[model samples]
Target: MKSMPLKLALVAGLGLAFAGATTYAPPASAQVYVTQVGVAPPPPRFERVPPPRYGYVWAPGYWRWDGYRHRHVWVSGYWVHGRPGYVWHPAYWDHAPGGWRFRNGYWAR
Candidate 1:
């Protein structure tokens, strides 16, 4: 009788733990729009390009602005799956009236 109640409690605890784990959601990987006034990102850093990968395109690294640190940070290059009919536009920084604006890489026809 005592053993039965203990087993029941253990099973209930495990079920609750599993239920909590299932409800957890990870943070999104989307980038946020940021505009820095009177600040320009540093020059692009040199990264050794890896050997070509089948059906993939190498996206070069670039300087990314760090808002918290108020400076530029180097983001490493990575391979992206190639799209048959689209071109991969690498991210770049452009001069704007207010400041330097960041344009994200995108696929275009």
Candidate 2:
């Protein structure tokens, strides 16, 4: 019957709509706060930074803690789009009373 074809078209349209909705992901605005104690990370390593890009800021490299290996690992730096009226803060580790706290790189005024 003619109605069968009409119903199939409607179902196909709905399927495509739902498929795209499932793949949608929201943009991330902030980094998760992570902290550790006991073993402090080794001294920061010297990295030769490349020439700066016109419209991007270079984020310096830093050591990140590997929970499974139980040691600090080096994370390479990269460039990010420059935000107007904001400064990019590089990630770093700070020693405090309990342990070392990892501050995520963020855009700040």
Candidate 3:
């Protein structure tokens, strides 16, 4: 008799937890825009860094946001190891309502 009420409460608690988990808000979208000041200078020409192994790849340079200048700064080019089934997207600066925004480079598997 007492166990019946306890079992009902347990089921109701589990149901509420599952419902809350499924109702979580989705992540906000990435903002994209252009900014004149945030443009980065051309990357310096230099000898390419040797790949760690034969299959490694090079990820190119890009600009990053600098808060003090209200502009973007250059992050130099570098080599990265290639993953078996991934592609590297170079980083870039985008203007947004807030200010100049930087999107970091990433390897997409």
TM-scores, all candidates, are: 0.66, 0.69, 0.45
lDDT by residue for model 1 over 1-109, one digit each (tens)?
7999999999999999998985554343345354555788877888999999987889999888777898888899998777677777888888988888887776666
Select the stronger candidate by TM-score from 1 and 3: 1
Give candidate 1's TM-score.
0.66
Residue 57 in model 2: lDDT: 89
**Candidate whose lDDT is highest:** 2
Ranking under lDDT, best-scoring first? 2, 1, 3
By TM-score rank, best first, the candidates go 2, 1, 3
Give candidate 2's error at residue 67 in angstroms.
Answer: 0.3
Residues 1-109, candidate 3, lDDT per residue (tens digit)? 8999999999999999998985553333343344444344444446555546565667777766566886546677776656666666766665665544556666665
User: lDDT of all the models against the reference?
Assistant: 0.79, 0.83, 0.62
Q: Candidate 2 residues 57-79, lDDT tens each?
A: 89999999888998889999888
The RMSD of every model to the true structure, in order and in angstroms, is 8.3, 7.4, 11.5
Give per-candidate clash totals.
0, 0, 0
Show pairs that collide, candidate 2. Answer: none
